[model samples]
Target: MLAIRLLAEPERLDTLALPVRPARGEESRPEPVSVTTALPAGVVEEVAALVPATRLTGAPGETYAHLRPGRTPGRLLLVGTGDGDEAAWRRAGAALARAARDETYITFALPDDASPAAVRGLVEGLLLASYRFRLTDAGPTPSLTDVDLVVADPATHADAVEAARTTGRMTALARDLTNMPSSVKNPQWFAEQVRAAAADLPDLTLRVREPADLAAEGFGGILAVGAGSVNGPRLVELDWHPAGATTHVVLVGKGITFDTGGISIKPVPAMKLMRKDMAGAAAVVGATLGAAALRLPVRVTTLAPLAENMVSGSAFRPGDVVRHYGGVTSETTNSDAEGRLVLADALAYAVRELKPDLLVDLATLTGANAVALGKRHGALYSENDGLAADVLAAVDAAGEAAWRMPLPADYVEYLGSDLADLHSSPDRGAGSVTAALYLREFTGDLRDRWLHIDMSAPSWADGDDAELTGGATGWGVRSLLRWLATLR
Candidate 1:
């Protein structure tokens, strides 16, 4: 983690400078302008003159650097802030951080027009881009440690800066958990981590149900999914309620530690990235922790049904019917679609017991969703327009991309099964929507307040880029946290 501190002004210290520029044309080099008006008068002009105006356009991720000739040689980094929106600023911060990855200490000033919220986004981008999972020492240690955030009004933006710090920390935690290999991060390990996290949070209460408890409580969906793995299944519930909080929001996450596609096995290549299938659970945990840490004035309950979907004689197979928590029977059409199965039990439990005013479930449920929304955005489905609008607003505010997808009532028939109440979608078309429709059956009358997010794409990244350095992106944490804040 980068140690970030707010600075009222830039002193006479040798630091890496960050100057923003507008995006460049396709044929031209970027000529970036100085968004660092808050920097000392001569610093911006001096840095701008160092790079040729037409040599580099100020495009996002575009970088230009020069070493000033002096007793103390200082590095100047010019980054592009394209449209100067929250996303652009975050990209600019990421580019700058990536460019200065080897530095021991780095300093950059926020743009003058940057709001407190925008400043937070900038910090998040920088931290996210600098992130590297080095648990096994396969990569070099991170050189950049201390970061100085130059702000014109530190006193006024203190609260926002602190909030950004908390959000960034939580996001990183989620990413770390998501990036862990399945060999090390089974259902028990996940439960222990959540327990430890909840112990530190004063307002949060932690509950873990082992395999016996799950069986006794009739969480058949979770049990069936984990029947093949040597490690048993677990259902973890975390609750955070503040004083005088009236609105209750329940977050359910699918916790498939490693998905092998069960008896309906997937291709070898597709199975490689299955370790990140639990990203939804990690996001919900991170969001819950962030809300508690920030002291948000809303009650939040997080439910994660943790399991491993493996191939074995004991594994639940196709044509098998498993009754979920609310006695909703689902016939398995494809075991690879097991994420929704585990989530089915959790959603039903949340609805029956928690009775939240709003219910949102996040899952890496389908490749069809990735095909529909691509890797850059999560697919959000909600029949209720008002709920969709609120979630979209929060997504915009958090700068996490999510496209609203439809849940047509007619598509519910795709999940029809003669053997059970519902069946997992066998067809490839509209698979994401149909999966959501399947889960909706468990919500009972609470369907109006339900929102399903298929985050199969955005939850993990394939390669290092400007905003995120590959691996787990912690996709839903920011949006969930922002949505919770609005409820206050």
Candidate 2:
């Protein structure tokens, strides 16, 4: 764990000025720009002149020049983001993150006039951008170790700074868990790891539901998904209820410890990365732990449907319809599409049983999402504008890549079934939307207030987000944490 020391004063951020600016066409030079936005235009001009550029000139996600002095060891990064809007702020953060390498420390000299939200957005982006997952013996952990934020009032930004650090920790933990092998992080092992992480936290309760409990609770999705594996399955429940929480948030994650595609087996190449199928669940547990550690006032409950989707005589087959917790029967169209089956039961239980104020489920549910957003961004689908907007704002503030995707009403026809209440998958084209639509059914009317994150691309990355060293990137933890902090 790397420690980034933050302070509210400008002394440290200002004292490290370079003597000479890097000239154009200069290789290995630092680009230093002053961040300016709607609220901080004055400081932008001031910092811009210092870099021989106008602070108000850099476009969002753009940079002006590098500050490479003769004596300084590190370069000064000048990131351009439009007026301190949340989107621009997040872009600036992404710019900084993209500029960092694993072994070095990067510092952001923020505009003194920016709002507290903008400052939070900037730091959140940097931290998320700096993340990396190195679980194998391939090489050492990433070098981008520390990030320093030079702000105006450290006291005023205390809450945001702590929130960012906590979120970063949670995301990192998720990445570590996702990067491990199936042999090490099987269903039972993963649940125990989550338990161990939460044991020392105050006011936090952890429960692991075995197959019997799942069966008793009518969680057929989890049972059938894990039934094929020798390792079995688990339902991990984590709860945090602070003193006066008004909004109760429920997060259900699809934790396929390893997915071999069951009886409708997948190609050998596809089976290799099934271990990371649990990335969504790992993300939920990590976010839950982060919220509790931060002691956020919002009541939080995270349900992870943990399992191993493998092939065996016991594995559930395609064309089989299983009744879920809320009595909804789903015709399994494709055994490979098992993530939604497990999530269906979990989401139904969360809505009908827990009746939370808001429900959000994260999963690497489809390769379609990956095809749509590539690895740079995660697709977000929501039936509620207000809730979706709030989540978008949080994602913007956190500097994680996210884009709003629609859940078309007409697409509901894709999930129609002849045998059961619904079909697990729609016929091919626009698969991502169909998957979102399928999950929407389990939400009932609550879908109006619900949000679905198709994290198929982010959960597993091949180093596309330079910060992530080609493994589990711990994608959603930071966004969820930042959102929880705002509720508190």
Candidate 3:
């Protein structure tokens, strides 16, 4: 994590990043944008004097970083804040981070009129872009150690700055867990990590269900999926209950630590990417912790069904019919679709026991969602129009990408199973739609308030872009945090 400091007035600033806007009209060579700020009277004029030499166009993610030794400001970085919007600030922050990757320390003066949201977004981009998860014993680490955000009124924007820092730290936790090697990231390891993290959070309780407890409680779906692996399954429950909290939100995440596809094995190429099958689990855990840290006024309980779908003689087969926690039987159609099986048991349990006012589940449940919404956005599914609208609003406010997918009643026909109450995976054309419909079955009478997020593609980024790093993107945490904030 990068050291983030909100400075009211620093005595020294070796390197400075100045925000620039685009020129009025197009030209072969556009001049540097006019500097504007409430900075010291002489400082603005100093930067303005060098604008002609900078020769920088204010494009998002564009930067001119150079260090002039013995100069008052040792290094000057001109960052483009396109349109002076939240997104542009994020891009500018990211560009600055990459450009100054080798620098030890840097100071950036916030725009004179930058809102709290823009400040938060800028820090989020810089922190997330600087994130690096490496396992090797010997390698170069990111040289940029600390960052200073020079603000005019630090007291006014202090809360927003902390919120951004908290979000960045929590998102890093998700990324680290999701990027873990499959060989060691089994059910037990997942449970232990969740427990350790919860210990640091006050008033947040954690309960772990071992294999025996799971068996006694009739978690047939979770057990069936884990039967083949040497590591047995586990269920983690993280609870954040504030005094007099009226609203209850239950979150379920599919924690398939590693997916080998069992009897219905995927191609070698697809199987190689299975380490992040548990991205959903990491996401929910991250969100719950964020809620607890922020001391949000809503009660939150998250259930993570941890399992490893491996190939062995004891593995569940395509025709196997397994009863879930709440007696809903599912006939497994594709062992590769094991996420929904464990999720079914978790969701059923949440509805039967927790009885939350609003229920949401996050999972990398299907590839079809990527085909529909692309990698940038998660596919959201909900039966109730109002709930869907609320979630989409939060996603927009949080600066996360997501699209609302339809839950057409007609798609329920694809999940009919002669041997069981539902089909785990329908081979129908609309795999993502059918998958959402299958999850709706476990929500019981509270189905209208349930939100299903298929974040399969968005959870892992192909490369660094915007606020996302190269590997695990920690997709759902920000959106979940924003939605939780909206409650009450």
Candidate 4:
């Protein structure tokens, strides 16, 4: 974890300077000493003069470096913040952290016009970029141990700073869980981790249901998916409720520990990254714990169905029909589409037993979502306009990208089956939408209160240089946390 602190005095430490350029058509050189009150007396002027000939355009994620070589050894990193908006500040912060990875201590000089929200975004980006996951290897650790955010008024921004820290910590935790190897993180292992993480939170209550319990309780969908694997399935239910909370929000996650596509078996290249299939469960656990850590007034519940889709003689296969918790039968058209099968039982149980006011389920369900929205955004689908609007607002505020896709009534026809009530369509087109519609069958009357997030695109990154590093990005945690904060 990155150690973060709030500094009242900027002159105390050697810092990385973020200097915003004047807008186009402005005066070439403003007063050096009083350009803006954001920085210490002459910091901006010093940087501007050091690199005079080169243009100091304040584009987000842009950097310029200056080093003094005499008796007074010092380094100044100039970062750009175009428009100085929250989004720009976030990118700038990430760029600054990545650039200064060799430094032991660094401080960010906040701009004069920076809002509390902007400060939050900056802190989030800094901590996220500073993350390094090394469990057993004796590799070189991150040089950055301490960070200070130099603000104009620490007293006024205290709450926002704390919120940002909490959110960053939770997101990092989710990423760590998702990045773990399947050999070490199977169904029972994941349940134990959740139990231990929440054991100390006084406001949270946890329950773990093993295969026997699931069998008796009629969670057929989950049981069917895990039948072939040696590691049995488990359902983890976590609840956080404050004393006077009235609204209830339930989150369900699909935890396919390692998807071999079951009997249908994926290609070798696709199977390599299937360890991250449990990312949705990671986000659910992270968000629920975050709500409890913040002690939000709203009640929250998380149901994670953990399993591994492996190939064996007993494995579920094409043409197999399984009945869910509420007796909604589904024919398996493609065993590669096993995520929705596991989620079906969890959603049915949440609506039937938990009876939440709002239901949001996240899964890396379809590759079509990635094809439709690309790798930058998750696909969000829901029939409820008001709920969708609130979720979209939360996504914007949290700086997590998500695009709303239509759940047209006509899409339900694709799920029709000759043998069972429903089946997963192998249609390459709109695969994401069809999967969401298939899960809708088990949602019962809570369909209007339901929102499904297809997170295949944003859950895992493909490269190290991107804003989100390669591995689990913890994509949904921040937005879900912000949305939970909005509950009355």
Candidate 5:
């Protein structure tokens, strides 16, 4: 684990990193902004002479590194923070982390006018952007260990800094859960991991329901999906109820530990990445842990339906009609569309038993969402306009992206079925929209206050971008945590 320390005042340092922003009013060319630096006048002049040739205009995610010559070698990095926004700061922090990868300890100079939120964003970006997860038998490898950020007033930004550290830790945990191999991460394994992570947090309580418990509870959707797997299925519930909390929010995540598409099966190329099918569950767990760590004044009940959609003799067929909790049935037209089936059971349970004031569900429910919105944004579907706006606001503040998709009433017809009350997948177009609609059926009368986030694409990052590594991105933790802070 990397240690992120906040410095009250500028400390004497041989290695100094300074933020370089774009030219402001009445300026045409880029220049290194004044910061807390210990560089001598001669060295500063040397850097001035080389700035033009380097073409470092302070673009976000850009860095220029130069070694100062002397009896002792010193390092200098000109990091970019475009427009000084939260997103820009995130990019700048990532670039700085990469630039300083070789050093054991380095100091970053924060602009005097930087706000607490910007400082928090910078810490999160550096922590997550430098993230690398690998399964190895070798003992812990040494790498960049300590980051000391010099801010104008550490006292003013103390809370933000600590919050950023917590956010980064939880997000990394999520990425680790999603990046684990399916061979090791069966439904039972997922439940045990959750248990271990929540052991220290006494305010957070976890309950794991095994296959028999699920069967007695009438979770046909979950049981049918996991019937083919030897590992069976689990419903992991975590509750965080703090003192003086009014609003109750229930979060449901689709935990398809490995999606081979059940009986239908997936193509060879697609099944390779099925390990990330449980990203939604990972994200919810991250958010719940974050809430508990931060001690936010809100009641939260998180439900994760864990299962492995594999192929076997007992696998549910495509034509099967499965009954969920509360007796709602889905005509399983496509075995590949198993996320919604499991989510239906969890959502129905949340509404019937939890009686939450707000319902939010996250799932990698459809590839069509990825096809439509690409990997940069999450597809958000909700009938509650207020909830949509709040989530979008949090997305902006947290530097994540999500586009609001509609829940067209006319599309409800797409979920209609002859054998059951609803069908899992649409016959033709609007796969993502219909998937959201199908999940909405399980929400019962709480449809108006529900939010269905189809995070199919954004859950996995293709490459190392600003504030994210190459594998599981842990995309929802930051945004969801920020949104939860606004409740009540």
Candidate 6:
């Protein structure tokens, strides 16, 4: 964990000739200073004159300039954000986070007269941008250390600090789970990891419904998708029911450890990054752990359908009809469309077994969503207007972008099948909506209280960078956490 220390006085920033003043027990600190629209004009001009142009431009993303503070063990870094707009400031913050080290300290100097809202926004953006998955520390540790926030006195800013801490922890957990490769985080490993991570939390209970249990219970969707792997599938449940809870929020994630598109088999190049198919599962477990740590009053139940949809002799094939947990049958039109199948059983289990008041399912479900919304955002489909509004607000608050997607009632026709109760994949057009329709069949009992989040893009980045690490972004956890808190 990165240590965050707060300093109040405005003079503290200049006294150290760095963004954040040094404190006792901290040997070396990064001189990296991120400026926003909140930055004073004089400060921006002065820093701009000192740093090189190339560093100035690149500083918006990943470049840094070194500054000498005479006796201070570390160097000062001036980060430029072009016009200093809010988005620019956010990018500048992400750039600093992407450049930070575990050993070096960072201080974000607030503007002299910045509003409380701006300060809060800056801290949230910085924490979200700085997230990384530092699991075993198998590689070199970071030299960029602590995060310092120069603000008003703690007495006046206690709420801001608490909010920052909460968001930071949420981001860290999401990053940790998303960063793992599919090889090390398959269905069984995913369950074991969740158990180990939350073992000491008395408020949390982690349980894995293994292959035997799933088979006996007739969870054909999960078993069919995971049969290709030697590791097998599992339904991981993490429950947190605080005393005197007012709301019951249920989260279902599609945890496909590695997807080879099943027997429908994706092209080799198209299937290379299939490991990230389980990002939705990663988000749920990560959020559950954070919520337990936060000790929220609302009762939270997380259900993850863990599987590896690979191609093998035993793999479920196109035209195969699977009997899900709800007693509904699905004709596999495209084995690549396996996420909804696994989720069908899990969602059914959530409503039938846990009986939560509301349901939200997250999955990297369709390529159509990426084509529809692009990267940096996910598609949110909800049956109820109130839930959609609440969810959109939470996603906005978390700064993890999401757009509300329509689940067209007319597209229900595409999923109709003659041989089975439903078709897993309909026609290619409106593919994302059609996929949601298939999942809705299993969720008919609770249509008004369900949300489907398609997180296909942010789970894997196309480029190599520190903040993203070219792996999972753990996209949905913070949004889910914020949403759950609001429910209470």
- For each candidate, the alpha-carbon lDDT, in order, equals 0.84, 0.76, 0.87, 0.83, 0.87, 0.73
List TM-scores for all candidates, in order. Answer: 0.94, 0.81, 0.95, 0.94, 0.96, 0.84
Which lDDT tens digits does candidate 4 get at residues 443-484?
889999999999987999876542477788998999999999
Candidate 1: C-alpha RMSD to true structure equals 2.6
Query: What tens-digit string does per-residue lDDT give for candidate 5 at 1-488?
Result: 57888886655466778777776666576666666435455655666665677887878778988887672227788888888887888888887887887888787778768888778878888899888888885765436788888876788889998888888999999999999999899999999999999997878988999999999999999999999989899999999999999999999999999999888889999999999999999999999999999999999889999999989999999989999999988898789999999999999999899999999998988898889999978999888889999999998888888999978889888887899988788776889998888888888879889998899899999898878889999988898899998996
- Model 3, span 1-488: residue lDDT tens: 88888877654578877877777666634334443335444556666655557766677778877666876677788787777677777778778888879889888877657788888888888988898988995887779988988777888788888888888888999999999998778999989998888889899999999999999999999999999999999999999999988999998998999999999999999988899999999999999999999999999999999999999988999999999997889998789889999999999999999999999999999989889988888999997898889889888876678888888888788899999988888887888888889989989988988999999999999888877889999888888998999896
lDDT of 3: 0.87
The alpha-carbon RMSD values of the candidates against the true structure, listed in the order shown, are 2.6, 5.8, 2.2, 2.2, 1.8, 6.5
Candidate 3: residue 390 lDDT (0-100):
89
Worst lDDT 10-window in candidate 1: 28-37
Q: Per-residue CA lDDT of candidate 6, range 32-146, in tens?
A: 3442224434555555555444333332344454554543324445444433344444555566665554435666665444444444544555666555555576877556556
* Candidate 4 deviant stretches above 4 angstroms: 22-44, 70-73, 136-139, 426-428, 465-467
Better of 2 and 3 by lDDT: 3
Query: Model 2, range 1-488, lDDT digits (tens) per residue?
Result: 44555545332332132112233344533233333212222433444455544433455555433444553323445566565676576556656666555336655556656666766666656666666554456865556666666666667777766776677678878988888888888889998988889987889988899989998989998898888888978998999988899999999898998888888788999888888898899888898899999988899999999999888888898899989998899998688999999999889989887899889988988888888988768899997888888988887666577889988788888787899989887785888889888998899768788899999887877755433546788888878887887885
Clashing pairs in 4: none
Q: Any residue pairs clashing in model 6, and if so which?
A: 31-77, 101-143, 101-144, 101-145, 102-142, 102-144, 104-143, 104-144, 104-145
What TM value does model 3 have? Answer: 0.95
Candidate 6 C-alpha RMSD relative to the actual structure = 6.5
Q: Deviation in angstroms for 481 in model 6?
A: 1.6
Best prediction by TM-score? 5
Ranking by TM-score: 5, 3, 4, 1, 6, 2
What does the lDDT come to for candidate 4? 0.83
